[model samples]
Every structure is written in C-alpha cells, then in structure tokens.
Target: MEDPYEILGVKRDASTEEIRSAYRKLAKLHHPDLNPGKKEAEDRFKAVSAAYDLLSDPEKRGRFDRGEIDASGQERPPERQFYRDFGEGPGGQKYRAGAHFDQEDLSSIFEQAFRQRGGPGAGGHRSFNMRGADAHYGLSVSFLDAASGAKRRLTLPDGQMLDVNIPAGLQSGQVLRLAGKGMPGYGDGEAGDALIEITVEPHAFFERDGNNVRLILPVTLKEAVLGAKVEVPTVKGPVHLTIPPNSTSGTKLRLKGRGIRGADQYVELKVALPTEEEIELETFLKNWEPKHPFDPRKHMRGR
Candidate 1:
C-alpha cells in the first residue's frame, strides 16, 4: 500500500473536488473495461479506487494524515512497541519466522493488539477487528434499461458472475450494495460487501435531467399549422402525439410517467420546414400576410 495522495497523484492539501477529479481520471484510464485483459491496468484501477475510498472519507483521511493509521487504514502501532516487536536485530540482521503466517491467526493477533491498545473505542476493553476489503464494480446500462430497471451481470475479480438488479429511477453515481459478496472473511468474521456504481449511457435522442427525460421532436410546418398526430419516442416506446394547431417552434408538450420513475417526460417542439420547397413557399407567401400582423419585437425597440 502507498500514500493515498501519491496513489491518486494529488497533493496532501488537495481539496475534495481535486481529489475526486484525480480519482475519476485515473479510474477511467485503468478501468478493466477500458483495458480488457490488462492485469496491470486492473491492479492500478483497484489501487486508485482504494485511494479514493480513504481520501473521500474525512475521518479516515484526517487519521491517516495525523499518522494515527497506515496507508491501508490500519492502526499504526506505537513507535517503541513496533521496534520492540519487529525491529531489526543487531548488525542490521532481520529475524526469520519458522512457520507460515495463517490469515486467521494473524487476524486474531491484530484484533488482540487493537484491544490492548484501545483502538476505535475510548477504552481498551472493547474488541475491534477489521472488515474484509470492500469490492467495487462499475455497471453500464442503456437509457431504457435504466428507466425500466433491468437485471445485469458483472464479472467480479474472483471470476464470479454476479447478478445485480437495478431499480427504476437509478441515477449515475448511485451505489448498490451487495452484502457478503466481496473479499472473503478471516477467522469467523463475515465477508465484506460489494459496491456497484451505476453509469447510464447517453441516449441518441433523449437526455436526462434528474429523473426527467427531455427530447427535441421535429415537426413539419404543416403539422404545426394544421395540427396532426405525430409519432414521438418515449422510454417505453413510440407513441402518437397531437400537435396543436398554430403551435410555435418552442412549444413544449408533456407525456406523464413516460420518463424515469419520480419524474415527468418533456417534449420540445422543433418546427422543421421543407428546405426543397422553401423558394416556392416564399414566392407563394409574397403577397400573403397574417390577419393580425403585429410586430412581435415592437416592445424591444429603443424609444
């Protein structure tokens, strides 16, 4: 493990926004999907994620900066105690252990150390143990898939296929927790949880604002003037929309419950004229005028 700031390529005094920006840049560059079959990139992505997790947490970052904890968020042992237990021997020689380190046994030892040193709790009586590392996965969903909710499959680091049920109205950056699906536990501890982040792809014609979906629909000049039923696209499917007679180019129409749940759908009118017949239409309208031909911009003229 390395310093989180170093891992994220940020200064120790970097602002929250700067930290987040750096993390996002690094994460995207090293994401497994972007670097398929590249183990090094995957590892870097994990490191970047871990760094962001610690730095994003105010309490953890403060503790880390104050030397109260190590880069892995583990409590740092007292200088004197650490030296007494695992310091180098005379002549700069290191001591070798006879047996292999058992993870469960090591966890128990660390737990005992925490209890003895009054970790987390104020008093030394409370027992505290570290949870297994949390796992993170990025999920990509289509606009309709996000709106309608869908089941998605993710390949985890352990080569396991995890099925995630995305709920309706899910937004980008929303995290879904899958309990006991992360790193394996040590001793009798429970497994860590998985954190899946949502990323909805951009739609070709629809845009999301909060839970609302907005669309710009093109209508012919005749359709706008005469009023007609035109097909409009929605999250569900294409449906017929009525264009009111004399509707303006910027007029807005509403389709209730057609967007993501908890929001409404808005359709903005974009009146499109037939370019090929423009000359003929202009010539025909040369002598024609509106019955109430008032200057719409009259009020804007300077006195």
Candidate 2:
C-alpha cells in the first residue's frame, strides 16, 4: 500500500484542517458518482479513503507512524524482531523453530499469548484489557430523505435503539457513523462505534443526475406545435414551465434550484400525438397541409 501521507498529498505533520481539506478535495474529485465506470478512480478513491481513515484517527496514526501497526491496520507481530534474541539460550543455547525456551523474551511472549487465549496464568485468573468490536448495521431511506435530511429510530441487533441522523445529499452505500453506540467495551475500554450503511431507495418519477434530478415530461401535439405553459413535477412539487413554440420532442428545460443542493431539475419533453378519434380533427388535418415540402430527417442518409 502507498503511504498515507503520499495518497493524501500532505506532510506527515500536517494540521488537522490541512488533512481534512486534502481528503475532501480528493474525495469530491474521485467520488464514484462524479467519475462513473472509472475503475482507476474507484480504486484510488478506496485507497485514499482508507488512508484518510488511518491518518484522521489520532491513535491509529500514532500507531502507524511508530511501527506498532501496519498500513492495513493489522498489529505487527514482535516475534521476528525477538526471534534472534530468543534463538540462543541463556548459556548460548540454540533453540530451533517451534522449540520451547525459558528465556525472558520467550516468557513475556508466552505470558501475553496465554493471557490473550483466555488461559489462566500462574495466578489462575483470566484478565481482559481490550476494546469491543465495532458494530455494523444497515438503514433504508427514500431518495428525497437522502436529498433532504431525515431522522430515524433504528433498532440494533442488541435491542438498543439509536436515533440516526441522515445527512442531506448523502449518496447510496455511504456509511453514517454513530460514535460509541456499538458493542460495549471490554472491562474499562472505550465503546466501539456503530456504522450504518445508507441505502437510498430509487424514485419512481425522478432520476438522480449527480446533484441534479432528471424527469421526462409528456406534452400534447398541440402543446408541442404551439408554445404552452404546462405543469411539471419536481421534488419541490409541480411547477409551471413555458414550452417554446414549435418545440420538438426531446427538448429539455431546466428548473433552477428545484433539485437538491440548489441543482437544476432537467425536464425532457416528449411530444405525444393524440390518440382520440375525432372526425372533425381528421377532416381539419386533411384540409390543412404543409405550405412547402418539409422533411424533418432530410439530412439523414443512412440508418
């Protein structure tokens, strides 16, 4: 794995704001929604996020810098460093791999290993000094609820209920962390955090386009032929839109600030021909013909 500082483009001693700014900038640039189907960007985004997670936490960062843990957050085993020391016995005695020893290093390792394994030591007592594992949960939310913010009460597996705050403009699959709400800590350790992955339900009429909302509006033949004002559905509610005269199908109109975060809601017009069978309308259409020969697709040469 690349160094966390290099991935975040910050110095090892960077300030909190500097680290935060770097992370935010990179996150926005490499967000999956912004760069869809970009595998390289997605991979980099994951790496960057992991790096930020490690560096952002003061304790983890300290451990990483001090060589106590690896970049992947796994605790480094001290056996290798102490192997040479424990290889030789007190009087230059050589102990091969898997060989038992009674040296100080071997005794320390055995004591810690036995304690972790829940085995009673010479004192015939089990002791635990560790933090509890973080808990994970899932939450379902509506598209609008994700666009706008909402609060929900969720019951965890442990029967603990937590009030989750859904942030505005949060994307699907994003996690909402509730600190100290996970499994209780061991002994006097701090409680683990609760991580809730947000699942935003798809909307029926509205489609998400980055920060914008997209919708298809059907217009009548007369409305398309001549300019008309029509009501269009938006997240904020229905609003009147002015369609230009002689507007063709696939014409788009932008309703400014109608989407989340002040994004414009784009409406594409689809001209629908009338299906009502009226003798008067048929007779009028037969009598009224184009003044000149016109072909809408005259420029097309081949399919």
Candidate 3:
C-alpha cells in the first residue's frame, strides 16, 4: 500500500480535519457508483479506503508511524513462508503440485506457533466470521421526483431488485443506506449495507431555496397599471392571480402552498412593455395624466 498522506493528497503534517476533507473529496470522486466497470478507478477506490482505514485508527497509525508495520500491515520481519513439493507415486504415476493447506489448517499452524506470544489466534483456532463487502450505487432523480418523494427500483450487485423510497426534499450528495443488501456473508455474519447517493438534475424554470421554490413571472404594463386577474404558472399548475392597481414593476406576489411539498413561497413579478408599440402608447399617456403624480425620488435630492 502507498502512504495515506500520498493517497489523500495531503502533507505528512496535515491536521485531522484536512485529512478528513481530503478523504471525503477522493471518496466522492472515485466512488464505484460514479465510475462503473472501470478497473483503474476501482483500484484507486480500494487504495483510498485502505489508507483511510489505517489512518483513521489511532493505534494502527501509531504503529505504522513507529515502523512496527508496513503499509500492508505485515510485521517488520514478515513471518510468512511458502513451500512446494513434487514427487513420483509408488506405482510410477506422477503427482501434480498443488496447495496443501486450507484456512483452518493455516490458522491451526499459527495458533500452535504463537500461542505463547499472544497473537490474534491465541485463544485456540476458531473459524473466521466476516461481514460481506458493502455495495455502492448512484441514483439520478428529477427535480419533481426529489421534491414530491417518489419510489424507484434499484438493482443490487447480487441481481436482486429493491424498492427504494426517496424521501421528500432529497438533495444531491445525500446518501441512503439499505441494510443487508450488499455481498453475501462469509459465514453466519450479517451482510453489509448498500449505499445510494443521490444526484438531482437541474430544472429549467424552477429553483429551490431551502424548502421553498422560487420563480420569476413576467407581467405586461397594462396588468401592472390597472388591476387585472391574470393566469400565472405554478409548480402544480396555472392559477388566476389578482394584481393590485398601480402595482410597481418589481412587485412580489405570494402564492400560498404552491411551492415544493406545499411549502409557502413567493413569485416575483417583472413588468415588461412592447418596445415597438411604446411610441403609440406614449401619445395616449400624454393625453391622460393622473391629477396627483407620485414622484418616487422625492426624498433623495438633499441626501
């Protein structure tokens, strides 16, 4: 294994927060869900995971820093050996070479050799029980799907289809964990979980701010000057809205419970005029002037 600092792209004297930030960045980048069927990215993900596993543990990190263990967790002396043998049978039949010991046999051998030294198998040789590997997946959702809460079908690594319920207001980068949905267990141990990361697509006309949805509505000059009932667009549908008499160009109007998840939000109205017809409208405006014209810049002359 390579150095944890190098894998995370941090300096050796980096703080815990810096290391954690780097790890999160790399984890999101090389995650298997983002890069499927890419062996290079998978290898990089494994390397990052291994580095984080070691550095996040205080005891293991101390031992590694003291040179007591190498990057792969082997002891300094590396107390492991391999032997091969080939011999002819009694009836002149040649025998092919093969591995001779299973995991249990190796465990027994190690237990006998290091029982007094308090190794991992000091308390007699026992069968290993390990959890399955955790699975990762990425899910893409539409803007409405994220806001309204929808159900989706997710296929597991073992060819199992799962029904996933996406919660309301689901944002990008949010992770959902499904228990016992990963690889199969080795023995009686439980299976690992499956993690799903969400990626919400951008909407053309709507934007979310916290739990509310924002939109810009365009209104004609006549609608702004004289009170009128006009149709306005909402996430649900279009509805009739009443514009106040003599409303300003930048007036904001509120449509209760029409935003995401029936949340309260406001729609800003911008008054627009037809540039080609402005000359004809100016002649009408000159003939019909209000008796009391309100000057918006009355209080700014002295300041």
Candidate 4:
C-alpha cells in the first residue's frame, strides 16, 4: 500500500486540521457519486478514506511513524526470531515441504514454521473466527428523492448491485447500513456490513431549512400589483398560491404542510419586469401620479 501521507498529499508533520482539510478536498474530488462509473475515481476515493482513517488516529499514526505498523496499519514482522523452525532443527531433523503428512500435523507444522506472519491465521495459533471488515461507499441522490423518499440501485466498485432505500426527509451525510454486504468473514464468522454515505444534491431553485422548503418565486409586475393565484412547486407537488394585491418584491408567503415531514414551505415573491420595453406601460407610468407618495427606501434611511 502507498504511504498515507503520500496518498493524502500532506507533509509528514502536518497538523490534524491540515490533514483533515486535505482529506476533505481529495474526498470531494474523488467521491464516487460525483464521478459516476469512474473506477479510477472510486478506487482513489477508497484509498483516500483509508489513508485518512490511519492518519486521523493518533495511536495508529504514532505506530506507523515509529515503523511498528505498515501503511496498511498491519504490524511489521520482527527482524529476528529466537528459533528458526523452517530449516534443520537442533537434532538435525529437517522439515521438508511436499511430503505427505496428516492434515492436523501439517497445519500445526505450517503454523509453527511461519509464526512470524502476523494476524490471526499465523503464529502457530489454532483456528479462529474473525468478522469481515465493513465496506464504505458514497451515494448521491437528488434533493426531491431525499425529501420524498425513493429506492435506488447502487453499483459497487466490484460491479455488485445493491438496492438502497432512502427514507423520507433524509438529510445529507446520512448513512445507511446493509447487513452482510461487505467482505466475507473467516472460519464461520458473520460477514461485515456495507455502510453507504448519502449526499443530497442541491436544487436550482429550492432551498431547504430544516424540514421546511424555501423558494424564490418570480412574478410579473402586473401579477404582483393585482392579486393573482399562481401555481407554485412544493416537495409533494405543484400547488396554487394566492398572491396578495400590491405585493412587492421580497414579499414572503407560507404554504402549510407542503415541505418534508409536514413542514411549511415559504415562498418569497420577486417582482420581475418584462424583458422587452413596454411602450404603453412606460407611457402610463410617466403620466401616472400616485395620490399617496411612498418612499420605498424610507426604512433603510433612518429607521
């Protein structure tokens, strides 16, 4: 495995915040959801995550720096051992390979011969059960999908498919766990889980505030001046909204229970004028005079 520092593109003496920032930047770039169907990017994302995992842990980082553990976080074998079990023994009895022997005895002999090999299976140890490592993945969903709940099939890096169920009102950065979807276990142990981190994509016109939805609704000048009922969009669907007469830009209105989880939807009205020149309207405005003069900027001046 490549060095964690090199993978994250950080200096050996980088601070925690610096490492975190680097990881975040790389993660954002190589996130699988952002680079769909790109195997290289997905692999890079996994490597970055693993690197950050090792460096973020103080104990692991210290061990790695001290040469006690490798870049993969596995312990390094000692340089020398007291006894050499592979070659000639003290009495000149040699252990030769490819020689037929009892299954139990061969297992014991191999374990003893390779005692320096680290982890559960080595070191002359008896058979043991070990749970598999959990697999991590990133998934991206649309804002509406997250708000309304939906089912999506995710294609893993290994080409395996998993159906993910997104719950209603699911927020960004939420995690969903799939049991037994990770690597295989050892010696009858249970398989690990697959942890999928969800990222919610932003909408062009809609914004979320907690459970409530916010939208900037553009209205014509005539519609704003004379009350009109317009069809507005909500998480559930499009609904008619009543616009009050003489409403100006920045006017706010609310639609009850139109947002995620029964939350309200707030619409801020923006009065938009016609793009082309309106000869009649311009002439009317020039000749028209209000009975009550109003200063729109009065509140901003001294109040």
Best-performing candidate as measured by TM-score? 1
Off by over 4 Å in 4: 11-46, 49-69, 73-75, 78-125
- TM-score per candidate, in order? 0.77, 0.59, 0.61, 0.74
Clashes of 4: 0
Better of 2 and 4 by lDDT: 4
Write model 1 residue lDDT over 1-303, tens digit each, in one string. 778899999999999989877876787788777788999987888788778777877888898998988887676876555445655666976645563457985665566566565465443445444566566566778888888899998865434689999898788888899999876655456887888878888889999988889999999988998999999999888988898999978899998888888577899999897867577679878978889888868999996
lDDT of 3 by residue, 140-238 (tens): 788888887899986443335778899988998798988997556765668977777787888877788877888777788888888789887766778
All candidates' lDDT scores?
Answer: 0.80, 0.78, 0.71, 0.83
Clashing pairs in 2: 89-93
Superposed Cα RMSD, model 1: 6.5
Ten contiguous residues with the weakest lDDT in model 3: 77-86
lDDT of 3 at 121: 50
Q: Report how far off residue 82 is in candidate 1 (Å).
A: 6.0
Instruction: Decide which is better by lDDT, 3 or 4.
Output: 4
Q: Which segments of candidate 3 are over 4 A away from where they belong?
A: 1-109, 112-125, 133-140, 152-163, 199-202, 275-277, 286-288, 299-303
Rank all candidate structures by their lDDT, best first, as comma-separated numbers. Answer: 4, 1, 2, 3
Selected candidate, larger TM-score, 3 vs 4: 4
